[model samples]
Target chain A: MNEGAPAGAELLEVRGLSKFFGDVAAVERVSLDLARAETLGVVGESGSGKTTLARCILRAIDPDAGSVRFNSANGWTSLHSLKEKELVPLRREMQMIFQDPFSSLNPRMTVQQILEEPLLIHGERKRGKRVAAVREMLSRVQLGADALTRYPHAFSGGQRQRIGIARALMLRPSLVVCDESVSALDVSVQAQIINLLEDLQAELGLTYLFVAHDLAVVRHICDRVLVMHRGRVVETGTVEDVFERPRQDYTRLLLSAIPSPDPDVPLKPLDRATLNL
Target chain B: MTAPVLAIRDLAVEFKTDTGVTPALSGVSFDVPRGQVTAIVGESGSGKSVTANCVMRLVQPPGRITGGSIRFAPDAGDAFDVVKLADRDPRLYDLRGGHISMVFQEPMTALSPVHDIGGQVAEAILCHRDIGKEAARAEAAQMLERVGLDDMERRMGMYPFEFSGGMRQRVVIAMALVCHPEVLICDEPTTALDVTIQAEILTLIRSLQHELGNSVIFITHDLGVVAQIADHVVVMYQGRVLEIGTVRQVLKQPLHPYTRGLLQAIPGVVPPGERLATIASVVGDADIETPHPLVALADGRQVSLPPAQLRRVARS
Candidate 1:
């Protein structure tokens, strides 16, 4: 069945997706589309199911129902129900970068080992050329060649993240989900990483699902934005549309909750009038 | 402006590394007026924590303040210089927690892992005041209650691990205030907590500041937290003060380019795939060549800057 676009037009799609933990629905009837080479940001507070949805898409955790489909060079395929053998090769088509750079990268492994491990497991790149590929990826991420010999501990928090991004891109995945990638970094380092990601996306034709709680960071990077509250998508629109004119009351509250750089601007007093208690 | 209870002038800190000396703080000067809540905002490695540690004389080995004077106004009219005091002086110990307490970033590591939560809170009270175990326990419970811990008595006996992230922070707050210190230094106290919990904690700190009328030095990267709590803001970079002004002035009409860039870097409250506004250059990368060591403003106050050759100076 031909959808709104051609067979390989859309990069990824989630239709009526829901994840249930016992009796409660973690994600309820969620649907979204990510076009090829687009950066989509997902904004939400903790426990908003943004992470759960990312897990469901990555198939790190299976979704209880609905479908996660990917459009690739071969054809469009549903990822939600794929068995291990079937999904093995397709796993290369998508990858994820976690929030904490410390835990995400193996401390014991040298940067060389960490970079090579993914290419080895994915198997698209030949084993004989893996070293060269590893070095290439390192340089692409703006890291020096000398970094190949260093351990994770030797690098600062920002440098560790560049390595993390390099590791995720080693598979040549079509999509990367950066879940709070810069939240742990200091401000200057965060800016460096953001610029690196932007440059990489332009060069590599990569699409990103940028999930973070920091509104200013989201403002700087995402092309389109969505706001999640509790377990639902309270507001969804282009970054300009949502920030300029948020429709939902909850969206407004979340925006207001964001602290502005102007210290003189009075904090949106927590609406004591609105608190149920 | 109210007279500063804690006045620091020409403050500088140096760490003796194997390669020589690394100047972490240089000519850092500021005033924390009594009854005011001031925020020292900067990125990581900007020496925000070092400034806090210097004030407490908790600078570890190889790290020492080679220069500067930290004056604490005498309650009865005289003043004492903090840097001149010995590291282990009884007076320094006496001032700590009793006159100036601190709450660190991570509550999990800050609290004793083996001790019951109540024991830790009571210990802080016992250190500053002459009190028996029963009296300390009662004070601990009451302190916990003041910091918004419900069922405070029951929670006291529980270990730190058993408490939620927010509750553990509350316990730390209780411990800090157990002695009713005149000034409080909170170094990213809510960094580990969720937004809703952070909101609650910010609200609590504001209320406590109002009630006690003590000065506060809040060190954090989150401008939102700064907005919610700070009466004045200190923007620091590379261990030096970049901009110091009223919170409104810094946020609304930032003078230093670094300050402006920092304000621009906050993510807009929306989802991704949108055009996010970003500051063009990183903080440490910018270079400004100005002849004057300190620029004089219309008010006759001079703002300090690093050397002209140094690339870290903030532009106009």
Candidate 2:
């Protein structure tokens, strides 16, 4: 997200999005805007409905109420209003990357088959073109072409994640929803993947909804941060505003909980009792 | 200086697989001081867990301790050589739960799904102490409460599946500390938990260790966790101990090439938009650059070599 992004151009907009599982409200009337080529972070504890909110925006699972409007090449389109048949082409523009690279990717499939599958699903049937696209994506993700022949089990967790990224970027999606994508990796490998994500975003002008529990990662990658607590958005601001001067007690508690790598800064987690968490 | 509670010297472990022998730990050595948290930090397959398993005498089958001496120095009397002990040694049973215990990353694997929390914790107490069931249960209740689990009586009756991941980890800690083990091996205990839960657990473990005055061997890849809890740090890579010192010394002034690269490459520590310092992916011998006589930290005053990798070649 840089100078090329149109001023005040909105790529995706969610208005009062809500989802409930039986009696429980998984996501409660959440509203946010993702600018073109901007990376927005969603941070919260487990079971705080961040994942549900992401799913609703992507229409991976339908929201019970509210509307999701995405600015397609054709212009503004309501994602929820589109029928399943009409949603097919747009689905390519909105893709998702998962946390566990091991389980998300098919163990039986080679890297080639895995990357090519997405193109096939979107109706790109030419074998030569699919192979070429897959190779290009692989290089972009910093994985070599030799990796195409190996199974997921053959690669390390980091390498498998790179393959996963390559697969997600194969269709050149405009928006990518990364749900705890880098959380599972070690710090070093996590850095490598983050760098790759940043590079790919810069080159291809991709928008990312990076959902993670690590506040440091959110601060590092996202232009703005959204803090969620038990199915509601508690805070949303620029990374500096939320991290340095958080308005909500819940946001402050989450920020206080992050362990600084510096030894001099002792970890001081706020008491849950104080915030009534 | 007081003798260390655990002393590992020239530790070498290997697996006799179909492909051939693969060394897991070769000449890994470190001293874990008494009442201090010594963190063994390494990436995946760095043999941190293997070292823990070897110390616990839990390694089986093709996995073998080819060479080493793991000495457990009790507060009183003789220093027992752990590596020389037989598989069925009766003392291993006592030393395990009585003196040393482990809390793992996955709490589910440690806690039985069928067993009630109280019963499992009480069983551990009974295993090490000559106590009645009622007395053991009472002590178990205290342990559970100490681990930050409120409503211990009610939670004790619940099964593993009924509790959240963080709550279950507390139960695991309770069972591990039931016998009051002198050495606690926590292998990435907070790795699976969220940041808030991780902070709480780290605090709990630190407080418990402070209260009990017992030594802890915490194995993790997260440098931030090491900074949070460790008094002493041991940096390992590919089964070798590359650097060893107090946490301040290791983290603040890293001497090894790999350690330097690791510290600089972390995301949050460095300002955003700057490209992170990266170590070479292939890391057999880190003498990739021309050996300079010195290396710099923040100001490059210490010695001038490559800004990231070490200038000098030898640690010995």
Candidate 3:
């Protein structure tokens, strides 16, 4: 494995991954390898199977076919075939951050209870140790310990998202799947969260499966990006190659749709005839 | 410059919640020139929606307009004060759908699930136009076609639920424009849509604006959309105007620290390893004083910049 190169040793290998809902194939034969400490972005519009792929990888939803292998301390383990009881320990190595901060966290639970739930479920026996770990993780997310006693409703959207990030990092997972985590936030607040994510990744040496619909966001954070269209991977390349010199027409269309903030550069709307819809 | 079609001066709104009276908007003033788009850009809770609501006289009880005036001047009519009008006044009905119309963020909520699309649109025309049902329905179908809805004559009979997200939005636009209002207020109109759909809607709005020659008040948080559509831009933060200028001036040469921070904070423009500048980092613990001096650009665009910042820009 080359430490300096963009590609590192494979931390996760997903082969022939497929998920079907009724007659629709939400995800189809998706195969990819996530390098250790590398951020891989999956870009697609709604119904393109990006969310389905993330859920299948996390075992939140069962895939109809294919295997997900993770490189563990002991050896490689098949995540898809593992029984629910046996998969609990492996879950600590992989965690997810959801899209909506308002609904993701429990409204009834205090910040402490929300963050410590995973630890308690995973059998961390010492109460003092859990409190210490929770406090430390809160600081990592740039939140104060004073937030622990307060409910989710008390905090703003940005702060609630920070708590979500803190909860995901509680177990110190090597792989963090952020599923449109910053999409709902205001632009300024989104920037703050993105910066925090980058800082945390550097400090913790984390691998990220950054899934988003926004092309600009994917370009900013990912080393490599995969463009999915109609449940199929249309293009996969480095961020520069995918964004600057897209090989597929769909990718080009997606890129053009991104409204640039610069007033000097005007983008014409895609013509109906060109789309061939 | 031509006289503004609508002018908002020193507007103030307060929400009386259980905790206390929280001021949502204070001293917000702007003008909507004829045949141009003015975008009010802000983050959540920055009073953008409240300003729009005040224009339509839709601000409910517990959320009252404490001060200021909204002046409406139609092309060939006497000017009137919108703020002074009572909620139950008969004149408000004429102004709302006749002179001003609005499209909300969520199309599904704005439209009725039970009502057929054509009937609803026709009803809007009937409210102000004194037209017969047949003529109103014909105008509704024509408006739907104008908004680029396919098979408009048949699709008008279908309920809103039958339409996709993008299609539903088109229906909403058709209904809003059916009355042929002088001003259209679109609040985050494309926020819920996919990117391609957003582009299409934007194009539709631009083309419709050109064809109808109506002034537009575009409320959005995305600077990208503002850059694309707005002739003039107003940047708001925490219920106060940070800066207001022509699109080119504000986006190209932002002077206020908050405006500058917002421009730098967008992700795609920065490289992968580089950190994005944040608002908190730019304005730490210091409240920016209001009523900054307005600097006139070479192109006649006005930017609100503090004197110190203006001096710094001049030196640099």
Best by lDDT: 3
Most accurate candidate by TM-score:
3
How much does each candidate deviate at the interface, measured as C-alpha RMSD after superposition?
3.6, 1.2, 1.0
Q: What is the DockQ of each candidate?
A: 0.40, 0.66, 0.76
Judged by TM-score relative to the true structure, which candidate is superior, 2 or 3? 3
Alpha-carbon RMSD, candidate 3:
3.0
Model 3: residue B87 alpha-carbon error in angstroms: 1.8
lDDT of each: 0.80, 0.86, 0.88
DockQ of 3: 0.76
| Model 2 ranges off by over 4 Å | A1-9, B281-316
**What CAPRI grade goes to candidate 2?**
medium
Model 3 Cα lDDT, one tens digit per residue, A230-260: 8889899999999989988888888888898
Over 4 Å off in model 1, which ranges? A1-9, A16-29, A107-113, A124-136, A149-154, A223-226, A229-235, A240-249, A269-277, B16-20, B74-78, B113-119, B132-134, B151-159, B268-302, B306-316
Off by over 4 Å in 3: A1-9, B283-307, B310-316
TM-score of chain A of each: 0.93, 0.95, 0.95
Over the stretch B1-316, how does candidate 2's per-residue lDDT look in tens digits? Answer: 7999999988999989999999988877788899999999988888999999988988886999999899999776688989998778877888887889999999999899899999999999998889899999999999999898888769889999999999999999989988888899999999999888899999999999999999999999989999999998888777877777778877987777677878877777678665555555423365623433233244322332354444243332
- Share of native interface contacts present in candidate 3: 0.85
- B1-316 in candidate 3: lDDT tens per residue? 8788889888999999999999998878778888899999888998999999999999998999999999998888788999999778877998887889999999999999999999999999999987799999999999999998778768989998898888999999999998888999999999998898899899889899999999999999898999999998988876777677789878988767778777878886677668877877776654565666456555555555667666676565
If scored against the real structure, what TM-score would every candidate get?
0.85, 0.93, 0.95
